[model samples]
Target: MRCFVTGAAGFIGSNLVDRLLAAGHEVVGYDNFSTGQRSFLEGAGRSAGFTLVEGDLLNPDVLRPAVAGCDIVFHLAANADVRFGTHHPFKDIEQNLIATFNVLEAMRAHGIKKIAFSSTGSVYGEAAVIPTPEDAPFPIQTSLYGNSKVAAEGLISSYCEGFGFQGFIFRFVSILGERYTHGHVFDFYNKLRNDPSSLEVLGNGKQRKSYLYVQDCIDAILIAVERADAKINIFNLGQNEYCEVNQSIGWICDRLGVSPKLSYTGGERGWIGDNPLIFLDCSRIRALGWTPKLSIRDGVVNTLEYLMANPWVLDARG
Candidate 1:
């Protein structure tokens, strides 16, 4: 199969690209480096079956050529930071909504049929159920980032229904693993690496959420692509276990061998659109014969080890 992955240099996208290439598939990767890094795609470039295209999804010229001759399109590009959306709503709108429209349009033009979209658990907002299912009603988004994802999902659904494209939407939880340039784990590691004496947490540390390792995330998408035959299939991708913010801090502290003074701004939700608590009912995806192997502690430890080895951060505090 020939696959085109947008945000191909991002943490999850890069991981997925490697998996696709390993499965003997030709992959064309596209990224603007907005949040993605070229270093993440370096390994894929070395593969004979892999090709990289430098471009933004907002540009049809770049998108159309990048997506040409691809059997499946994995649309992962977006403004991923939830906090950034609060500061710049238009940035999220353009990067997510506009960028997604361009991808769907390009796919339509090329007569491509399948798309596995990278949606978010944030789209569910604050769920009433502990393990929310695919049938769960997605509420009005709490943040601009979440709103943008909701819009993107809608666009994909519309394309599937109106244009007869096969689509799979995976609503992802907190993803943590190697090649991660940003996220809670990365933020904590950098803070402690620079100043081991103090760690500033975003929320009051009581907020809880589900997490998924990068490998598990990639595997779930693969399963979706291979098995999904519906016009629009939706799945919640996450680990079954839930972890609190303070518990995550403790795990990081234990792994890094640093006990810092933990301080937090008082709030349930960390930011404007942040959901304090939400656990995914991954049974939908699990029923498809895929399950996450990494526990919260295991995933955190692995991520810490990766950061220690990679050292993407600088000793600027010194």
Candidate 2:
């Protein structure tokens, strides 16, 4: 198979690139390196089957040609700054929503019939339902990042219906594993390293969240692409259970062998678009015989270990 993956130098995209190459598939990687790290693609660069293209999705002239002759499109690139969406209101619209439209157009022009998108569980906002299902009704959107993803999902579905394309949209919980650059784990680790004596936490630190390991996430995506053939196939990729923010903090602190004084920002949400709880009912993906191996605690610990080993990522992100 020939696969074209956007955000190929990013956390999940780089992992997926290596996985595809290991499975004997040819991959064309696309990224502009805004938040992506070239160091993450070190392994993929050694593969004869992997080709990296430095380009932006907003530029169709470059993106269209780069996507030519691809069997499938994995659209994983986006502005993931969910915490600061209000800072730059148009960042999500330009980078996520508009960029997704460009990818679809490029696919359409090249007659590419299949696409897999990285949607987020954030789209559910503060849902009334616990362990939110794929079919759960969406509440009013709280963040620009989630709003853009919801709109992108709609665009992909429409393309599938009108152009006979197959779309696989995976709504993921907070993903963790090797090569993790951003997110709560990274933030906490960075803070602890600087000041081992104390750590300032956002909100009340009781926000319940579910997380899936990166490899597990890639496995679920590949399985769905191979077995599920629907016009628009949507799946929630996450662990069945969740952990509190405070629980994750404990794991990180334990691993680092440091007990930091904790201070709270005093709110349920860490940011404007932050959801206090996000536990996805992944029965849809589980029905396809896929289950994540790592628990939320394991995921958090592993992420911290990776960051500890590769302290360069901290500098790169900064």
Q: Whole-model Cα lDDT per candidate?
A: 0.87, 0.94
Per-candidate TM-score against the hidden true structure = 0.96, 0.99
Q: Estimate, for each residue in 1-318, the C-alpha lDDT of model 1 and write its tens digit.
A: 999999998889999999999999999999888667778888899999999998988889878977889999999988887876767779989988999999999999999989999989988888776788878877766878888888999999999889999899999998888886677888888889879999999879999888888998898999888887788999999987898989989989998888899888888877787899879888988888997888978888888888889885323211
Model 1: lDDT of residue 224:
80
Q: Which residue pairs of candidate 2 clash? A: none
Summarize candidate 2's per-residue lDDT along 211-258 as a digit string, tens digits. 999999999999999999778999999997999999999999989999
Residue 99 error for model 1, in Å?
Answer: 0.3
Best by TM-score: 2
